[model samples]
Target: MAEISAVKEAWEIRQRFKPEIWFSAPGAKHYENRYYANHHHSFVNISVTGEACACRCDHCNGKLLQSMVGTPTPLEMRRVVDQLLDKDCRGILVSGGANSQGEVPLLAFMDSIAYASQKGLKVLVHSGIISRETALGLKAAGVDQVLLDVIGDQDTIHQVYHLNQRPEDYLRAMLFCREADLNIAPHVVIGLHYGQIRGEMKALEMIREAWPETIVLVILTPSCGTAMEGLQPPNLADVGEVIAKARLTNPNIPITLGCARPSGQYKRQVEILAVDCGVNGMAYPDEETVIYARSKGLQTMFTEECCSLIARNV
Candidate 1:
């Protein structure tokens, strides 16, 4: 009952403002919104590590990498970029598994990222906890955007990601990105603690301090081959509360629901809540979500691109 009240309060608060609904699902995602829309052949995700991951975090255990295009080396990444360009792809998300220390080995690909940017492809990187030097290097390389997952609870970091770093370390990383003048996006996973809500609002408060160009909210979606396969998923109402708090905290910043989250009926409910909470955008939304948003007289648009690109687009 408390959860329902919170959801209703947030929904009412959000309806007082005009909201925009964005649908970004790259690589052949097709949907209809007054017209047939598809995102395939325009945007793609590339795994810089192929299938290799060191940390093998409890939630993922590297299973997420299987969905990305594997590009294990700088040359391979560049080659893949060429193929994507040939297909007239608009952008690419360069991501990979992190090392044991929660760092993705992205330094080696700096030159390739610069090359891709020079070739007119929008490049975004999922760089984990990185050094100041790396942040500056990414800025110099002209990478379009950088995504850092911010965790507010130390236990969540240590137990879930198995990292020795503290929550302050994540804040410091965001500071480095800001110092480097890079377009940075901070992602807060709503239910990262084994499908339980933990410190998510605190994470948002921390991001408010940094004032990033954009913020992304993604929920924990347990994969079948991972340790958390049978774990209970996050509650839709709780996820809605986080989104509402984020809206209250950073009214001017673009808030988006990223491509990762629970699916089926849960996804529909959560997406609807996100819209009601005044989120700026959503990634890979269902057809019904678009219809719902339209029914509420909200502005809606679709792109065959990444949700992070919403910052650049706006």
Candidate 2:
């Protein structure tokens, strides 16, 4: 099949770069005697708004928020973080649905984040289109890092996110993080244009220019009950091409495949190709990928935290 052939070709082309294997699921994943050593209760995600989002993009329709434990107020978030720390959680990802401006109103929760940090919890915030003032607040709060999605295509921003903002808005946000001297891991969602590859390379170029602490590459997963539900995933080879370009553009920066993508055979195939295409790490990779990496005589390791933390951990 063409898909199989494309994967093989990409694999052949990917041998030039050294590879690093990552196993970053909060829970342990075992394959035979080998296991990804994870702190099952070490890290967790919390949503500020339970099952609610103003953007409600075509691909998500607020479904992604359902998986995150929701806390609507600073007091609630503080209470939840205390409970999680009591249970031995190492870090927490503070996330929520964005408002109409594609911003997660995190200013209101800054005090809670600071409180968690003071109580010795590593804090990571998914800050969307933040202002310099807000970025400073997050920095003063002792937050570990921030995650911001960078979209290169203007049309994708409008059509998929239903936002009138331009790519410059994203670039400016990264600048805000930099001005605050905050650690940031900028994410670029591949194939966000209705399951078709678009602007990934441009986005990578922008990220490379920004010089982020780390870069996370994720693929768009069309969630159920959304307009993009029936759309097929982009070609694995095309995804590989984007990865290859990213490697070439930012050779020193750490790039990892984040824990968001299509599942089943498609996911397995993409993982194998991702290893070859020079991604430094992967979040929750398939067992066969571990075997393949070992067979290629590459050293591998695992972490219980999110792949975005590789920059800080590794």
Winner by TM-score:
1
Model 1, residue 314: C-alpha shift (Å): 5.1
- Candidate 2 lDDT, 157-224, residue by residue in tens: 99999998988899889898999999999999989999887777777777776789888989989899
lDDT of 1 at 65: 90
Compute each candidate's TM-score over C-alphas. Answer: 0.93, 0.91
Separate clash counts for every candidate: 2, 0
Residues forming the 10-long window of minimal summed lDDT in candidate 2: 26-35
Give me the overall lDDT of model 2: 0.81
Once fitted onto the true fold, the runs of candidate 1 whose alpha carbons sit more than 4 angstroms away are 1-19, 28-35, 312-314
Alpha-carbon deviation at 53 in model 1, angstroms: 1.0
Score each candidate by Cα lDDT. 0.83, 0.81
Candidate 2, position 84, lDDT: 90
For residue 233, model 2's alpha carbon misses the true position, in angstroms, by 0.3
